[model samples]
Target: MPSVVKWSHYALLAGFSAVLPVAAYAQTEVEAEAEPEAATTVTDERVVLEADIVYENSADNTIIAEGNVEALHQGRVLRADRLIYDRTTERARASGNVIITEADGSQQFAEEVDVGPDLTDGYAIGYSARLPGDATVAAKSAIRRSDGINALEHVVYTACPLCEEDTTPTWSIRARRAVLDEESQMISYRDAVIEIGGVPVFYLPYLSHPDPNSERRSGLLMPNAGLSSTLGAFYKQPYYWAVSDHSDITISPMVMQNVNPLLGVDFRKRFYSGAVKFETSFTHEADFDSDGETFGEETFRGHLYGNGLFAISPEWKWGFGVETQTDDLYDRRYDISGQGDKRGLYSNQPRRLLSQVFVTGQGDSYYTDAALLNFQGLRGEDDAARLPLVSPLAYADKYWDLGAYGFASVTASTAILTREVGADSHRASLGGDWNTMKILPGGFTFEPFAELRGDYYMLDEDVSGKDSVARAVGNTGAKLAYPMVRPGTNVDLMLEPAVMAAWGFSNVNDPAIPVEDSLLYEFDESSLFEANGFGNFDLYEGDGKVSAGLTARALWKNGTEVSTTVGRRWRSRADPAFDVASNLDGKSSDWLASASLKMGKKLELSSRVRLDEKDLSLSRFDMRAATSFDWFRAVGQYYKIDERISPAGTSDEGIFLRGEIQFTDRYSVVFGQLRDISRNVNTRQEIGIAYTDDCSRFELLYNRSELRDRTLGPTESFQVRFSLLSLGNFGSDSFE
Candidate 1:
């Protein structure tokens, strides 16, 4: 038999339908949202209870619920095997498989729990919780205070994935006591131990971190340790400062056993329309001479780098870049820049650094820019006094549609260059070009183009002419091409043969006009049809020339592609001013050929070569190939330049090889080597082993470089990196 007894002042139960009156304790359902600290309080909200059996004791003012008991209050749900409600005290006690789910989908489970009337303040035994960010916490006991603070004892927390077959997590944190402050969104632990694969690896007396839901906060980031042959043992500890919602800064100080310490800082800020960032570092240390010997006195060494951009409107923008270092060997010795395997790091070395400020504007038909440029030379052979400083360089270009059959473009530029050893000059130039294409009979295409340009120069000193000179030049050319296509069952083939002839009239090359640009030249298939082979206006091709090329392409239905090109140029006469390496010094230039083949996504190969027409010998050759399989990937590159064909007047050859193999789902190996064939020496070599899983990653790398730059000599380094999910990374390196 079931009996319903209602208290005079409180309605503890509602919507009950088991052998009793169901309407006596009815009240309005609450309509309120859940909050992080606690659920919203609604005056009219009623506690709805359901169970297999219920008994009300009138004298004790208590209600007992048994067998799959459930209670809903203020959009929160509670479930247990048995529940007891005290009408006098306005409290609830649940035992046996107790579970509570909040409106935000967060869940808590325990064997037993005691809660106040609101369900926000509670105490539980054998407690576990699952929150956002894949975070889980389990503890022996948990207590929730009215101020929204959760205190737990003997707690273990982890974000790692757990498999039923293997209950051990990849990484976990064990703490004797932990406190979670909902108001501050932070978790603090005391006497904590970090374990990996059930083995304790690190311990801390006190530790605190932002909750997983926090985006940014002020704290100490992970530290780094390393060893260098030049700097000896090194360590860096960084602290992050969250100044405001729109700005932050990081300060890192590095300590070295053999050298002075270094301090680095990075600042970043966001604006309504754009963002800016700056990073800089400084050190006070004794400088090293060319013989790898340190000086008696200490000096300041530093680098400053920054960049920023903002939009005036949708089509107009402005930006500037800065890259300045105190000395040439500072970056190489300290490993300040080019820390990764980049092409520029290996091929170009740190020979130059550039700083520039510029503004740019773009419209539908025109573009313009103005800039000031400065360069710092970092090579032992370079003369810093002779380097030019370019100020107030301006350029603009506009395009116009010439009716339906042609288009015309106008370009203008001006520059002022100042140098210590060479003549200072201010120059301005304007040029216009027009082109039109027509399709004739027999499927042949014909195109005619004309260009005119004028230049005015003012010089502080003259070598071959007067102080000021004006010259005007023009060129007219025509191009003709015929295409043939053949469609087959499995492949489609296309062949196109093209010819271009142009007559140019320009002022003879003036020795007084320094070759500030266009100092390096290379003739390839892509430049075979250009009106001017020179990259800049300082050098003009001059006179009459004809170029012819043939292109062939084949495409298969299975996604294979092949393309080839062959081209050559014939000059009216050999020019004495052109160097022999340019290939343009002869009546008939060297043959330029290139080919590429791609077999879907598995393999790709490309090669380009320049051959001497007289002897049919290779003058220049470059080849690259890449292939990949399910478990392995390989890449190879080779380049060779004959002494007669190289601009440096020396034979240049090199080879680069890189490969990676994955032995298992969690382990991989990578290796690479760069060798200078002409010098018969290895420039750089690297090998690394890595392990990765859902929650953590680890890598060990060994690298060697045989570069010889003044005081900076060959070096070898070993590095170790460990990354744990949500906890940042730890890195260490040793160099010799």
Candidate 2:
């Protein structure tokens, strides 16, 4: 006769009796000692069964269970309305709503199943499985081989959710036959069809990919196709290679109908301490004229960019960056630097790409950096030969505690630059500053500071009558502040009056000391209290100055705050070393005013203005405001600068507005525009509509730009993007 058991037998009761030791009983029955039995008398380690109703049919050496039958074998559970087990053959058959749950928590459902001893090998009809990654597979018939191979026929697979209202998924794949290879974590599909919203969209003869549970694998990524006015029709196909656990690479080939194909490769590797990345692209294409016409010459155009950083110790690190291009217009002509109008008033159009290798160190009280830098000019007007290359630039700063109420700091920097324009120079400078503060009676505070700096330069082109020059400067200043604070139940207010007097003495100006680093000077509230307004060693304030300002701040209990500051500077005499365009060139500098307001977490506003003290006309003005609600957000920015203060000798005034409004839970519209107020034209504008859900997102966008360049002209285009959760993104051009 055979035995019957419940599913719990395999999990909790299979070896329960064996686990209890006989040695414990020997201690209490020493006088009745007996010889131990042979090991062959032990129990078999096969499946133990239990059920609500069980019967043994000795005629065939079989065990049959009916009415809530359950069985367990090798960490797997089987349940059915009726089950039969042949003990001699170690085989089982189940019928009527059969379910098998593996030790890994995966479940298989079938109306009928035939499984071997360990449940690893089985054949089932009406088979269905729920696997990891929220995936499900159903088939009319399934075969599970002992070698960990699963085969299914007429199968449907999907990861999307199923609701009672609609059984059709957002996306799914149907196949005539599929095989899952557990060892390689891959699934192969034959005669597969992809369906979206229950409608067939595409078909493939054969396809194979890593299972959804895989984190990394080599495969073809999503492809992109687009139409461009400059390039005609283009397509990009990208392939990703998972080189190793800590490294990967992607190679994308771009094909254009009218131009040569471009190949781009990106590589990345990570170590325990740092990471490195490199990207490069190349093409052999004909050059284009200013009017977007292809010319005679076929040129090799490419760009290489790379960066890496590693930690040498707890406080020291080293890194290098590479930025080189075959030609400046190559990127713009190919539409590679992302879509937008990059020539806006405050866009900081990157005319120069800098490459550098540096090592840096920082501690509690000191910091240091040393680097070698090279620059490549990308603009037609910039002469690459005139740009200086710094072989080595080293800087260090350290601070020392001067007991309870004072501190001292020293800074040193040196650089050697070379250029073809005969402006090569080498300079070294050191500076030391000390300050002490005291709190007087009546809520008054006073701080006095002093600084001494010395610089020595060697010039290759001595057009100013000297090949070498040395200069030293000394400054002393004192700051006084009086604060009044008033506290109320709902708000707190503070008002502070601050004043500073500073005196400077330095060597006479030497024009040969070329102004390289401090060419753009700005008089703003951030620099109002500095002893020397200049930020570099080449320029130093020649005389004395007095700076006065008033600051007010208010904070409310509702998490709202407001702050304002107004300041001005008065010099003893106008310094000729300072450029006339700099607001600090006169005895009385521009009036600086700044204010900010914040209302809770949703709104913020800030503005800064530089006014010509004589007529109160604005020399520079910048304002920004942002607000957000439950379903909407808005941001606005305005910037205006006088032509006299512009290094390029051009005035810039613009306003940028952006907003997003959500009409429903899953739909939203976003719009933005950049308008040149000075020219009364729109530089760029974009509008997009998007739909987003928990598992997918779709967006359609229209973009327009009016930026004109040598190789690139104004552009208008439309783009569409669709993203699926756990899948990749697909992008295409709708119009151009």
Candidate 3:
């Protein structure tokens, strides 16, 4: 039979429900939350009973209910064989198979339960009481709270159900007085004893984890240990700080008994506009344990890196980055990599600080960028092979619609370079070219092009009239090609013949401007139609140089491709030619050609060669090849140079090899080797391996040589990262 209560009683129930926030209930169960501690506290509040239930009044403010016993107050429901409510103390004692259902649908059952009026205080004296998740925490007594804050005395909490069969649990934490703060969303335990199954594991004064829904509750992170042959045994205790919803920081304090104290911190902040990231590591330790007396006190080593990007507008953006090092030996000592020069030829190094602020934008068919690069790391003692100095470079190009034909374009740029010598050199240029084509009915195309260029230069110091040169060039050419190719095993074939005649005027005396910015060319098709293969616009050749070239490109079955371009240049009249100041010159090369061939996703070969018609010697040769199999891949590249230059002033030959292999899903290895054939010496050989698991990533490396003479020995590193992405690693599903 359904029992009815007065409308006033309904108002009281509505008041209680309105005071509390609904806890998250399983989809099938109602989600309810405990009210603020003020109105309903552990020591206050009273339980309201309803349903066709019979109650017997007793002494000590106790009300005993039986037969479909149901107590409802503050959105919490409890049922049992018998119920004892102590009004004086606001505690409810339920016996005979007790089941206390929370507003969140999570329930607690025991042989006996002593709960407060609002279900904020009291305990369940029973065999065991499990949490919402598979985490079953059993103790002699379990205290129940409205906020899901359960205190289990003498408890054994484990996620593993079959204790006997699975003796080794995934992991568990046993503690005294575990407090689950429903408001803050954290489970904190005092005097906690963490264990794996039945084994007595580690002990900590306190421990905490995220509550049911919130996994990224920032707090004390886990500790890790690693052993390195160089650094001995080291331990790290990490602290995580959740500053806000958009920002977080992690500070790791590492202690190496064999060495000194080390501090590493990483900060990440995401704003509504953009993001900013930074990392810094510091270490103080003796050079070597045994040689401590010789080196005296401890050494200070550290590295700092940070960068950020800002989107000013939909099409405009800005970005800046900085990397600095305190000591060169920091890498070898700390097992961090800083090898080679402080700055790789491509690396931007700052002495005090380096920054680049640029606003860039691009549109269909045209683009432009202007950037200010500040390089404080450029020391006057650095060699040309080292990093470049801070300077300003700007380039803008636009394509124009030729009245009745193909297209016309104009490009202009300038640069001022301050070398390590503190000398300033400037180069400026403006150029324009036009291309027009008339297509025949059969698809043969007649294309003619002409370009005019002028150059000027100024230097801080010069000798023998080598400061400036000016030249004018005019070229005309036609391209003939047919797109149709025989089909079968062969998929594509393209052949084109090109001829050009150029007459230029130059003073023939100018200091060479090296191709510093364009050293390595990987994969780019922009070089096909350029007036000069070089990237800069400051130099040009003159004096009636006629050139002829043929291009052939083919694609075979299974995605195989081959392309080749061969051309020869002949000058009607010539005087003593300029020297090989930079490699991109045709003073003595009678024939220059480049070719590339790729075979079915496995192999790729490319070569560029220049021949000295007079000496019958190879002036320059660059070759590269790469191949990949199922589990392994390798690539090799070689460059050679030959010129009538003194030993002190000479070109270089080098070879580089890169390889990688995947051992398994969890592990992989990589290797890189660079050898300088010019000096008959191996520059570097590095091997590295990375291992990934649920908890974190571990990296091991063995490099014979690095950045320079710095040697990174067998070093092992471990990083335990915790993020929203890592929540899956917990593997805690099926909440009970």
Candidate 4:
């Protein structure tokens, strides 16, 4: 049985404080320079004393002392109501209220104790001890090995010093045996009963763990078990493999009644140059209803990924990543959804995975790039989206400086599509310029630029057998802005009036390419000048398009910054080059407006909108705001896309809000909600809270949505969570 102490017993132990005034002592030096096989000799160079001593000579040639005897040796001091010393044998024995103390602020007590001649080995029957901080332990019998090492038989250990009175912890373990090897700094236990509030919660045949001061140990991690309405009862046993100081692997085998046994693995390896990480899962059984049909399409899916960085030279380097996975229901059914929804859309056909490989070199003012691949999984209406098993194409480009007067760049690239609508397209462009110059009575600045572009396309028989087409285009533009300062509140204000006029001409026949990729063509800077600038450039006769637009902007700052922009555009004959519908009878006006504001250092707001001048219909509206304080933070965003275009789907609007609060250092909570305005419904709501204490912690989580439900509530659900995350003295292994 473990040692049990009463209140009076603790008071009695506290009474040992009367011995604190004893002289301090250092350790006796013992020469220990030999091989591992030799008997170690340790020396204690310091010893002190104070006491009422009674000595007795025994037939064993030992000298013993009794009656409130106290002495200090090495870094430890001992006290007892009675003690017997053996001078001839270099050993001592003590009984009746014996207490031992160490220099590091730890104390041990026992009813009867025996000390070794060299202080290297001893035994204390019915001993209890408290280490640094609030950690404490007790046992029916205890033995000291080397240094501060100890072993307790029938022991109980706890980091909560305040819980000393209860031998059977409310939520702790009672071990049949325990060993503390101080020299190696480790602890182990056998035949342990994991109890909670004096009740047995679990029983382990054998277990071992590291002490509070250790960082790594070879042991079994805590097992996890849970029940899900869909997955039934499940359990996961995880094992950790320490490959080295910087690398490790965790393999977890899952067992559940609703599905086949599953094996999940996470491997991490660190090299002198970089690191590599990978995770994968595999299973052998199906857990879905197939309308009573025979097992079809034997379930099989796994994920493998490896990415790292390498130093090519002093000023240049390269890195790449490959994220690939299988199983359409991998996220919804297995709880793997985190990155995006594209991976969670399950289909009977084999799903496609995207993979890309590219390299680029960067310098002070110029950069070069090249890539030999396809952006897999990007499906077009006419072709499948699966990744090609082999490399698709190669391309490269370069950019440079045209002195401080202006800048220019050139690009050339080609690609061969492999799908049914496949075609080989090549593009080459060269552009350069001149900037606006301001004549300042004092000091001023000016900026402007112009460019010329060209393109060539070759068609495959499967696409159109249209042979080929070549076109060239030119554009010229300029902008001038002046800063007007307001010295009233030290606020600098800038108001700029700018205009751009461009003329483009292109010769091509039969609208060279399709319109699959030209959706975002309107209101863009790059399309300012280019052959086939807009898809289906041949839809119009020889491109002789003239367009012009004027923009006004103002920037002002006092304690914070603010900016605004307003612009309008008009073109001759609704230039197809401007992506303006050729059917627009006469000249039409298009307008854009935007504004942003920031106050002090805590709050900010911004908004932008576009409209068609003819009908005055809202094109796009976006707004965002955020604020933070000592205890709370909140952020909100709104996005509205017109019916004209929305990526992948028709236009829709939505709003999202997120906030968090800190009650204390040990407690915090967070909340987030997403609402779809167009559908007049809530997308989702999430909330979570955490609380920590000296011995353990509790976590609560809840989420609600119409699409899916993980809890019992139709629109609301939550879960209670707890684990051994404390017991500070046991380091952080309590959670492992």
Ranking by TM-score: 1, 2, 4, 3
Clashing pairs in 1: none
Cα shift from native, residue 487, model 3 (Å): 3.0
Q: What lDDT does candidate 2 reach at residue 352? A: 69
Residue-level lDDT of model 1, residues 63-157, one tens digit each, is 77799877776666778898766667766677898776666665667788776655456677887765544556677877767786767789887
lDDT of 4 by residue, 1-736 (tens): 0112211122122323222222111111111233322322222333466456543355764444456777776566778776655545555566788777777767777887765544566777787777555556678887765566566688766555454465543355678877766655456677888665567877888765555445554444666666554456678877776667888888888887666667888787777665666666777655343111223465776554445455566555555545555544443454442223222111111233444454556666555544444333412221343232323233334556556555556544444444334554443333333344554564444444555555555655456556665566554544444455544445665665544454444333345553323434444323322222353222322333333333333344446777777766555444343333221213444456777788754788888777766787876788998878767777889998876545435678999998777799767687788988887767688778855556555557676665432221124446555554233221111111
**Candidate No. with top TM-score:** 1
Clashing pairs in 2: 4-49, 4-50, 5-49, 5-50, 6-50
Tens-digit per-residue lDDT, 1-736, candidate 3: 0000111111122222321221111110111143444333432345555435444355564455676666665777766677655556755555787665656554555687554455445555764543444344456665545655545566555544434555454445556666555567666667877554357657878776655345465776666665555566778877888888888899999877567778988899987767878778997765552211224566776877677777787776666665666654454466543332332113453333455555566666566666556554324354443444545666667888867977887776666666654445566667777888777787666666777665566655443234644445444444444444455554767777665554555443344544334434211123433434335443344455555677888887777888888776555454333334333344433466789988854988999876666765776788999888867788889998763422235777889998877799757676778887777666677667755433233345554442333233323233322211122222111101
Per-residue lDDT tens digits of candidate 2, residues 1-736?
0000011122111211111111112111222235334222232333445458776677997666778765566576667787766667766667788776667775667777666655556666787765444455677877767786767778786666566797787766788987766677566779988777789976979877665555677766767888776777889988888899999999999998778899999999999888988888998878874344688688888887777888999999888877777888777777665322221111122656777788899999999989888878888888888988988888999999988769999999998999887678899999999999889998799999999988898887555457888888878999999988999899999999999999999434577788877777666898888878876677788588999999999999988999999999999988777775567787988889999999954999999998878888888899999989879888999999888676667888999998888999989997889998887777799899977765556778887877776657777778777766555567843211
What shift in Å separates residue 353 of candidate 4 from its native position after superposition?
3.9
RMSD of 4: 8.9
Question: Which regions in candidate 1 have their CA more than 4 angstroms from the true location?
Answer: 1-51, 54-65, 69-79, 83-94, 99-108, 113-120, 129-136, 288-293, 338-350, 462-466, 486-490, 581-583, 599-601, 625-629, 634-636, 732-736
Q: For model 1, what is the alpha-carbon lDDT of residue 133?
A: 47
The superposed Cα distance between candidate 4 and the true structure at residue 380, in angstroms, equals 14
Best by lDDT: 2
Question: Would you estimate the TM-scores of all the predictions?
Answer: 0.85, 0.84, 0.61, 0.67
After superposition on all CA atoms, how large is the RMSD of candidate 3?
Answer: 10.6
* Residue 11, model 3, lDDT: 18
RMSD of each: 7.9, 7.7, 10.6, 8.9
